[model samples]
Target: MTKESLKELILTLEKIQLVLIQEGEQEWVYGISSIKRRLTDINIDSPDFKKEFKSVQLSYLNMTNGAGSFSDVMIWRSNVEDRIKVNKDFNALTKKTWELFEL
Candidate 1:
């Protein structure tokens, strides 16, 4: 990905983080949807980064579908853990992706 695209992705991830913190689990579907859409727009060439991104996406997808209510999707402990892991993984991947930018 180009530096500009990487920067955009970082911004998107930051937005996701904010949404997760302020809105909590119920609103995460929106953030995840935004992240997925943003991911599709970037050209990711690294296999490792692609894998990491996919991991985060899949985790969110599973959590989003685990419960009937999008607002209370994390009613279970496992679901809550999955969301935490997804956030952590996305944050790490975002940092790694940022390091690849030239300037």
Candidate 2:
């Protein structure tokens, strides 16, 4: 993928992280599957990154379908209240998730 799109995906992940922390509902962040789908293509040589990302993927799988319910987060996404701040900026999101992924 292009660098810009990758950044955008990472930023999306960051926003999801922000909402999960701020809103306390991890299942509401629907963009995770998008990021998970791209994991095989990231091409990062860091084993730690790979291991951590794989953990995320497995967690996502368990949360939605693997062992968890099929409750889709998109249904909740359409119901987000305006007062909740899920639309945080990319730089902050980037920085936050950077620390999270330990990249």
Candidate 3:
């Protein structure tokens, strides 16, 4: 991908990320659902999925309220989301936790 193409793709990914996050937060669905949907759309099951995911990794800094260092919020959050995708047992644990919470 040319630099311009990469920039465009990154912008698209950012939009996808935002939409996924909003859907997850608004509907109380797991964010991973949106992530999965978006990833799949980008041919995430293809042989190049892993490479593509890593190539366009996003990063940003954020500050909350008074007097704090600029924290790497977007990267941290993405890493967490990525972790939830990577850890094979996380979904099962999340389901069980939700079930217990609902009970």
Candidate achieving the largest TM-score: 2
Can you tell me which runs of candidate 3 are displaced by over 4 Å? 25-103
The better candidate by TM-score, 1 or 3, is: 1
Cα error, residue 76 of model 2, in Å, equals 8.0
RMSD of 3: 14.8
Q: Residue by residue across 1-103, what tens digits does model 2's lDDT show?
A: 3445446656657556565556556554454544545553565556566565666656545554533453322222354563233333323554454454444
Q: What is candidate 3's lDDT per residue for 33-80, written digit by digit as tens?
A: 443344436553468765655432321111112343222122223577
TM-score (all chains, Cα) for each model:
0.33, 0.36, 0.26
Candidate 1's C-alpha runs over 4 A off are: 1-6, 23-45, 68-103
Global lDDT scores for all candidate models: 0.53, 0.50, 0.38
Where is the poorest 10-residue window by lDDT in model 1? 69-78
Candidate 2 clashing pairs, residues 3+ apart or interchain: none
Whole-model lDDT, candidate 1? 0.53
lDDT score for candidate 2 against the true structure: 0.50
- What does candidate 1's lDDT look like per residue over 1-103, in tens digits? 5556656656665655555556455456465566656565655666567665665555545544545633243322358777787657556644543343221
Model 3 clash tally? Answer: 0
Candidate 1 local lDDT, residue 7: 63
